[model samples]
Target: MSQRIVDHPVLGSLAARNQLRFTFNGTPYSAYEGETIAAALLASGVRTLRVHEEKGTPRGIYCNIGHCYECRVNVDGVPTVRACMTLVQDGMQVTAGTVLPTPLKKGGHSQ
Candidate 1:
């Protein structure tokens, strides 16, 4: 798939192609480096970030910007990250955190 922001409703066409690779919950996914995690998630058709904090309600991207933390997900082993704020990186190991994003502690070390 084309990582460049060729066409988007909010941001319009991206200026250039930004190829990058990363993982989501142990599964590999693709996107451009530097693009906000939220935008990358949306581009990858990954709606439904995680269940609500209290009621466990389903949620997804609303604003591409970082004003809302609704699209927050576990990234680079960090929990409660605003995907829209964090930019993608090469060889990044991202973890989905819609629900309980607590890092999987492996012998007290987060994997």
Candidate 2:
């Protein structure tokens, strides 16, 4: 399942640029510089970004914009980050689903 836009009718073949290395669910994948996290995942054929916390239903990129929270992911231990809005950074560690770092309480203790 190739997700990259090989040859567009109007734009032709997209030129490859500087590649960035990132990990998704513990697996390493390459992405171009300036590409969003969601775009990188889509290019790598990762259809599902996460599962619903309560219902456990699969969730992907519904809205490419930041309006919908379906593309939420745990990035570098940060929870609930919108992947569609975040750019892919080199050596970034992105995890799917609800495996997030525990939030801190008012007293600086893990909740």
Candidate 3:
């Protein structure tokens, strides 16, 4: 853990891990099942979580408790998920959509 949080005050307690592996942008990392996705990312030194609809607007964990959608990310191709409220899973591929390599697709891309 880098900018770590072994235990949090409001998210309740956590169980000891038997050790599991997952990746964020192809980099392997670990976290417990009950730990929030945002918490895990932050613990592992992830600051910027995703970009907003407006280009260049940086967003992260504005509210650690999940009220704000700033921590939104696309999990397994599904978009607009609140990471602060989602728990981590073993072998889960957590890709940080904090910034897009391409601009927003207007009117959706036609096949």
Task: Give the alpha carbon lDDT tens digit for every residue of 1-111 in model 2.
Answer: 558776578755556467789999999988877689999899988989998875578999998999989999999999899999999999999999763333343554544
- How far out, in Å, is residue 12 in model 1? 10
Compare candidates 1 and 2 on lDDT and give the better one. 2
Off by over 4 Å in 3: 7-15, 98-111
List of clashing residue pairs for candidate 2:
none
User: Per-residue lDDT for 1-111 in model 1, tens only?
Assistant: 533457779865565566777777677777775576667767777777766764578877878677877876776777888777888887877765544443343454444
The clash tally of candidate 2 reads 0
Task: Give the candidate number with the greatest lDDT.
Answer: 2
Q: How far is 2's C-alpha from truth in model 2 (Å)?
A: 3.9
Where is model 1 more than 4 Å wrong at Cα? 1-16, 98-111
TM-score, cand. 1: 0.68
Candidate 3 C-alpha lDDT tens digits along 1-111: 566555668754454555556777677877776777888888888887776665767688987787878888877667777889988778877665654444346744455
Residue 104 of model 2 has an lDDT of: 41
Q: Which TM-score value belongs to model 2?
A: 0.78
Per-candidate local distance difference test: 0.70, 0.86, 0.73
Best by TM-score: 2
lDDT (0-100) at residue 53 of candidate 2? 76
